[model samples]
Target: MSERTKTRRTRGVLGGRSERVVLEVLGATVAELAESGYRAFRMDAVSATAAVNKTTIYRRWPGKALLVGAAVEWMRTFVHDVPLPDTGSLERDLIDAFRRRLGIKERVEGRAWARLLAEKNDPEVDSIIGAAVEERSGAWYAMVTRAVARGELPDGTDPRLLLGMLGAIVDAWNAKSPGRLKADLLEAAVRTVVAGARSGSLVRSPRRRPAPRAG
Candidate 1:
């Protein structure tokens, strides 16, 4: 290969490695945030944990929320598309999907996510968190919708509501224990949702609007 081609290939390899470094830094930052709340989060701590320069983190994310947001987005993307196995049964699919999703969630990012959700007040934080939730839940929601379309689930099955409940279950567990997400809880919650869905008991009931108070 010519010198120019060799240089281009070297750059390509370094670029890929840089991407991994950025991801690792983000993950480390999230873990640090969980350990020390936002008030005490420091760039040096993140740099030390990730073993990267502070400049690298700053270049990728200008602020703490932005860095944390990217980390959440990364974790969400990891769980976005689980390989769907058609085992000729809704139960099997749900179990596999639930395991795959929970496996990722129980890792480092999930612990940090739980901490962030508990302290979510800022609009920017809320937006980032909401997007991650939606992205992570998207595939499972699609699977459920497909089941409904195929008449495997009830005609009134609401993927949104089901997924909301599923997320709530995981979030609750995480809140109880910040360090770890329990696999048993995940399995139980998934089974309950899937069974309710199959039996037509988990339909989304319309919310009751508050009655007007007499002035």
Candidate 2:
């Protein structure tokens, strides 16, 4: 068999149109909700935007927050599938990972997600957001931990804080009007964060410091 045929067969293992439709609807609902304030956003509006019937919407999602929750989860979940390339260099891996995430955040759907996140205040919304955060963070943490294990990061490096730094760069990019988180910007931010992490790790541990240099 041809290599192309082999590759095609391997790539077809993921899923089908039904999955994409659900994810697309979830993303569309988020955009519609963001464009139209929560008070003005109704199930009918979501159903229409999602191109699914009210029955379908209700059947899949009991309510608006539930639907939005799914979309929020999907947005964060996208980052999980983008496995960082094993480039053997910390800077390259970090930059590539950030760039992969940045490309998603720069899109129209991503801006809508950012808007939804900014306006979130309801308790139900908070709960869903928390769950999404936990799910995606778990995945990213594993990737960073691997880097640390490979000595790409400091032994004592805080994965949580490092992840926060990466998240903040995208958040800031999304904060701008007509926001565009370009790859170049992502690369720069990754370089800076990696530099700081390396510098902090090189600092002599306070507990390990010699007593006053015997002055």
Candidate 3:
């Protein structure tokens, strides 16, 4: 978090016209990954979409693993960089966060992008995906914890379970009715989950630590 480290990261991630190229290429990389997947993804197609020379891409990222890993990390960074909503109400915050998340997903060819994650690729690619997903999960956990901290949620409300239930309900709702998420539907999901949480239905007991073995 020091200035030097921050500057170094900034330089590696973005700067000047290079920033634009990085974003465009990363976007195209995602789009390409969705369409062709990692095994079949090609730098030529990425260059065409990004309108940058293949050599240009190679100059920045010498290998496909590096480039694709960067693209995967870009998806995580794109989500992480956004400000989390704090609407002072847990329901409102959840709804707003879900809306923002969906918007980002749609912008990046979300369904295809998600499918790409399930495909078998290099171990390095898998590692990158795992790390990105772990960090993204933290964002959801933060949203839940903030609600609890603000007294909108009761003590012992399991953040993971609460978020999981909400997501599951929304996903089920989407499956039943194939369309963009309606405001009423989102409100209902948030209401149902929040009510359950408030009633202690979503409360989880703390896990007990195991006793030490012979040492």
Candidate 4:
């Protein structure tokens, strides 16, 4: 292909038929990545799975890393379309978000995420996962900001920390326990964090003054 053709493909100015072909290839790329993982993923496999010629994939994505990165981006956009709930309660909103995440874990996309997480040693895969986390965490940030605005959390509260704490708790429970997560447990954890944040207990205070040294 000429430089102009490559540029047009890269810029996504291709016609509708070509666009559909790219989408199909991306879908197959995701599936192939999930099944074979980054270490064993092959372009020929993706081409066969997508029912398109290998040249087509190469035209759109010049390399394996680029294709896998694009596949991860596609999955992120496809999976996270729904907005987080706004129920006038931060705890409830968090619970809903966690539940939704659990639901995702039961789907094919969830399997893909798990596979990606296991292969996070790969630079491209790691970058993709990091970007996906940042994108998904936007909703949590919004929820926390709303809580602050509503007086549920104190001003200057760190939304990222709060979200991280919740994620840690949920992840631990999911890994250590063999069954479904308990609603009460999730609620209690959220309540504890919120209570601490609200009462100023979780906030880090400045270093206390040292008394003058005795002569």
Q: Please, what is the whole-model Cα lDDT of each candidate in the order they appear? A: 0.70, 0.66, 0.77, 0.79
Q: Write the per-residue lDDT of candidate 4 for residues 146-175, one digit (tens) a residue.
A: 998997876667788888888889888877
lDDT of 3 by residue, 103-167 (tens): 65556556545655666466765665776666667877888888878877776678899988888
Weakest lDDT window of 10 consecutive positions for candidate 2: 206-215
lDDT tens readout by residue for model 1, 59-167 = 7788877887777676656544445556656666766765555565666665576666666675766776876556556756777877777777776678888877887
- C-alpha lDDT (0 to 100) for residue 118 of candidate 1: 67
Candidate 1 Cα outliers beyond 4 Å, as residue runs: 1-24, 37-40, 51-56, 81-88, 163-195, 204-215
TM-score of candidate 2 versus the correct structure, residues matched by position: 0.63
The numbered model that scores best in TM-score is 3
The count of residue-pair clashes in candidate 4 stands at 0
Compute the lDDT of residue 20 as modeled in candidate 1: 78
Off by over 4 Å in 4: 1-20, 36-40, 114-123, 126-132, 176-179, 207-215
How accurate locally is residue 8 in candidate 2, as Cα lDDT from 0 to 100? Answer: 74
Candidate 1: clashing pairs of residues: none
Model 3 misplacement above 4 A: 1-24, 51-53, 73-77, 109-113, 119-122, 175-179, 206-215
Please say which candidate is ahead in lDDT: 1 or 4. Answer: 4
lDDT of candidate 2 at residue 57, scale 0 to 100: 71
Backbone steric clashes in candidate 1, count: 0
